[model samples]
Target: MTHPFDLSVVDRWSDERTFDVTPDAVHAYADAVGGPSPVFAVVPAMDLVFAVAETAAPADLRTRVVHGQQDLVLHKPLPVGEKVTVRAAVVGLHGKRSGTTATILVRTRDAVGDPLNEQYVTEFYRGVPTDLSVGVAAPRLPSEPPAGPPSAEAAHHLQHDLPSRYADASGDHNPIHLDDEVARAAGLPGVIVHGLASLAIAARTVLAAAGAEEARLARLSCRFTRPIAPGDTLTTRVWADGAGYRFDGLDGSGATVLGAGVAELRA
Candidate 1:
């Protein structure tokens, strides 16, 4: 069962999309992720993911996709009302025993073409068989976490309504994050929070602990190790790692949900 979508056209660019980082959109994204600093002039980093999600993947490839991992590098803060052009390309495709993984590289720039941010989004299509002969396997994050007591920690409560709200705000209406039946069919215990939502909360916590502004967030990357149920309490733990920070997210029971988290803040 080869994948319905062609995987050989790597590096081919998709049609460019212009995203206006409006105040309303920024506020809505904040509200969706459970309010961060409400008065931020710089847009939330995950908004770039939302913008890419809107136009990155072809429709036929979206029906059964799951966000596997994400890497974001911000060159400059996206100010409200600025229109950024997003150009995406298929950077890599891999065939695994269970499915195919596709990597989308999204480059965001100012109207004058100054680089604003770069995002690498990985999506897994379960049960989509493909030829392993041609595709390369995506790199894996370390399963082991940093040792010692965390230098900083922050607890967050994911409200029961958050998934639906985030779905609306982020334009990610995957039923697995909203409909219980859909989740059950998909083998999830219940509707789960968006992985990017969890990442957002963790990133915000680290920035706050470092006494840094959201605009100072230069790089963030993480792997989702477990599903985050709506209404679960998440505790993010961070440790200083040279010029960057390594972190992880634990559920109420202390089980790791987001792992191998790394973030770099601008000086």
Candidate 2:
């Protein structure tokens, strides 16, 4: 189905965010995943969400928005201390009949101005079938919750140089990590790290920690509950249950920053 949309006729969210990446932040996240690190690409993968959210017009655009699907291909592992600036622009748009669904194309970049990733997201806007905005029929929350026992989960950490490389790779150039001056300018104790970067580290945690190869992942989803700064220790713990795994992101102090992480594996 085809719908209607215009960039010049919608809202812009380009200069709306700031961040910091600190030395302490590096240690925290790197320690969580593992001392060294393994390359788990997430640049364009998670960045697509940011790009779509920034470029899309929810108020003016049609409703019935449901996250249809997402995909990401990592070029290489991002190093810590790298600068990343995230900017998203709508590259393409197509519609489903009766406004039943629409696909959006977004591209993200890093601070040094490199193509970090591309995201194509689809939402079912317009033509309301029914008002079931709750329960299994409703959308799920974006934030994850604390994990209970260890059944099935993914665990990982970030390296000291990872933030800098990721910032450049993801186009989420928040100063918290790249610019110390910017970090001081912000009210944070220091530069705050990109939540997606942490999320990426968490995404790999499930695989590396569980000793499962990448091919084991069938489906994965999680919520960004808190912001993480560079140099901080981030530990992702995972557990297995039923046909999938439950996971969570933790701070150096063992605080649950991200929760309700789930991953379905293929047999």
Candidate 3:
């Protein structure tokens, strides 16, 4: 049977969106992600990435799509109250028996056209099969955890209402992350946390440990390995990997929630 999606329509196709990074927007993100630094200092890494919309896809696949991975490269830290424009293009797509994964390249620029961040966002369409698999995947990171004791560790307690708070802050009102019944219908046990929200929390923990809290973020990437539910405490572990750092998150039962995490900071 042929797949319903054309797949090539979005390939290399691009779109642009413009928005201002107001104080309220920044503060809401920081509060939701549990960032330690002042909310006004620097916008959260994931915030800059998510501010840009993903490249459009078939409407049939939209509801079944979920964030599969995120690879972010920050050229400059966006300050509060900056007007920025984000351009998103579907760079690649891979199909499998399970579903199709579309790799989107998102670029954000300040009002003066200064580069702020570049992100490779992967969206996975569950149970949507396709015979064609083309285009480049996101840049590779270490799949296995570092073989040594973690240099630093931080525990983040996710509140039961975290999903609601994060949904409000990130403008991602997916029912799977809000309504339990909807999540169950989607084959999830209950309302699961947004992948990006968990990623933002883990990124801040890694940054603080590297003592690059105030430094410009060079890169951050992670794959969503497992679902994280609300009211679960996550422990993020970071290891010094040469010049950059390797990290991952584990849930209460010690299952890897986020894997292949990599982060680097500019001097």
Tens digits of lDDT, candidate 3, 1-267: 576655554545444567778888877877888863321222333343333323345564566877888888878666568787776656677788998887777777888888887778887888988766666778987866798999999988889999999888777777899999988988889999988888888888887888776446788889998899999989999999988899999999999998999888777
TM-score per candidate, chains pooled: 0.85, 0.50, 0.89
Pairs of residues clashing in candidate 3: none
- On residues 1-267, what C-alpha lDDT tens digit does candidate 2 reach at each position? 222344352323344222233444455544543332222333333444445554444554422343333333333233345654444434434343444333343344556666544434444454533222211111243354444677444434445666576666555554566676666654345555555566556667776656666555644555455556666677777776666667778877777766666655667
lDDT for each residue of candidate 1 in 1-267, tens digit (9 for 90 to 100): 445665546666766777788878877888877666322222333344444444434675565677888777778777578887877666677776777777777777888999987777787777775754343333455577787889999999999998988777766677899899988877788899988888878888888777777777787888777888988999999998788788999999999888898888778
RMSD to truth, every model = 3.7, 11.1, 3.2
- The residue pairs that clash in candidate 1, if any, are none
Ranking by TM-score: 3, 1, 2
lDDT of 1 at 111: 85
| lDDT by candidate, in order shown | 0.74, 0.49, 0.76
Per lDDT, what order, best first? 3, 1, 2
Best by lDDT: 3
Q: State the lDDT at 261 in candidate 1.
A: 87
lDDT over C-alpha atoms for residue 211 of model 3 = 79
